[model samples]
Target: MQMSQIVTNFFDACVFFPRIIFFSGLLSLSGCSNAVEFVQIFTGNNGPTGPNLYHFENKEQLDLSWVKSAMSRSDYEKVLSRIDFKRQVLIAVSVGERDSVSENVQISRISLVPVADDTIVDVSVRVGMVSKECEKNLTSYVFVLGTFEKPKKTLSYGGFDMDNFNAGCIAELSGQPNGP
Candidate 1:
């Protein structure tokens, strides 16, 4: 079998596989700090919804099956082609569901930290929330694609919520004196 065929088979077997993280939410890392350079692959209010974090080691393992589920084939392919999987890994972060379309998420920063035998991928995300009330819910997502180098250590993903610095919308929405 060809390499692509083998990879396809391997990915097919693991499509339902879920990676376990040591911990998530906010992480504060000490020691040499370096920001992992990343580019936004795609961001929008769409389905395939729910809070999710995914990482792929190579192009063959990167599932585009979700293309038909929530995005266009052309757009997803374009993003896939941009990734040089040989040198970099792919990481995706989803914000799950929101009550209004006025809510959105943006990947603010990406960084890595060494802990014993593993590396923690700390993703800082900024959320935009408006005071609009909606009759239905929307899934807002920011798919990021990047990772650090390897000795092939166990990798964990965590998200740090950096509230949009503007307190006006937050305050108005929460009915609090100041934004939380």
Candidate 2:
């Protein structure tokens, strides 16, 4: 092939490859944009002892509620003060009781998807595995989120990990020859 033809082909190849890569990158980022951003107000294993999801719209609601029963009054007030109830809300996820204190809960991702006239808040959580038997303990996590509006309008869920933990753990234990 001629040198001119070869140079032309090389330039065209460079331009074509970058466009393809740029477009694909944009496509991938578009999918990730639905993940809602949240500021973690507090997260600890000492939350409510049972699986619970709390969504509070204002400080008055939180102040009058028992959701912070597991937390100190001062600490609860501190968390409440950080929130501007008019602009943000609080979401707490309690993983309930686990077999060991070593076990932990992680709020991996929070996403919002529009459905009909409302939105669905999907929370992705993961908990550490307890390899051995231990005293039952409370495991929980909390986050402060700022949505377009209060989260009362959104349908929320504990996501897959909270829903499937028991079944998955049982399957794993039963499948082993000698499980913990």
Candidate 3:
């Protein structure tokens, strides 16, 4: 080991007891941090980060529609774009006097597991939704997101809209992106 490593080892041996107590204390703080994150994960926070939920103005009361069921690869691409971006575009499916969604449920985040044989892949999405109207009130749901590819497929999507409501699939993102 290098001289610095030797010094570190000496300290590690000498101060192991004290360090353990310190680390234990930090772990408690970590639990609190994780609790906050858990709340955030389900409820979502207001910003251009984390999962994407469709939000739009209630312009003369519009109709926000959910994405259609997927039947092919193109369907996956369409759904992926809505959930992948921070500020997503929305399309109005229902014609109404109010916004497509009076209260929007942002899928703050989600995790997916796919089970498939040789010819077909069926996936279950563990989706977390926070009301855009009330961010603290978070709800989680398990959506059978129709069918799609295996987890190994690399996908890319940007933005789409139908009414003011935003709903769709997701792709794992690295870090986060700032709007252009």
Give the number of the best model, judged by TM-score. 1
What is candidate 2's lDDT per residue for 118-173, written digit by digit as tens?
44455666555544443243333322222234554555332323532332222111
- Give the least accurate 10-residue stretch of model 2, judged by summed lDDT: 171-180
Model 1 lDDT tens row, 37-142: 6776665444434555666666666664342235556866777777777777667665554443333456777666555566766666665665454323333432
Give the C-alpha lDDT of model 3: 0.24
User: Which regions of candidate 1 fall more than 4 Å away from where they truly are?
Assistant: 1-33, 64-68, 102-104, 131-180
Error of 3 at 172 (Å): 30
Residue 23 lDDT, candidate 1, scale 0-100: 45
Candidate 2 segments exceeding 4 Å error: 1-33, 129-160, 163-180
Each candidate: RMSD to true structure? Answer: 15.1, 13.0, 18.7
Which candidate order results from sorting by TM-score in descending order?
1, 2, 3
Q: Which candidate, 1 or 3, has the higher TM-score?
A: 1
Per-residue alpha-carbon lDDT of candidate 3 for residues 1-180, written as tens digits (9 for 90 to 100) = 899999887754432221111221232111100000111111111112222333222222112223222123464355444342322222211111121122333322222211121111111123322335444322221112211112342222112112223322222111112211
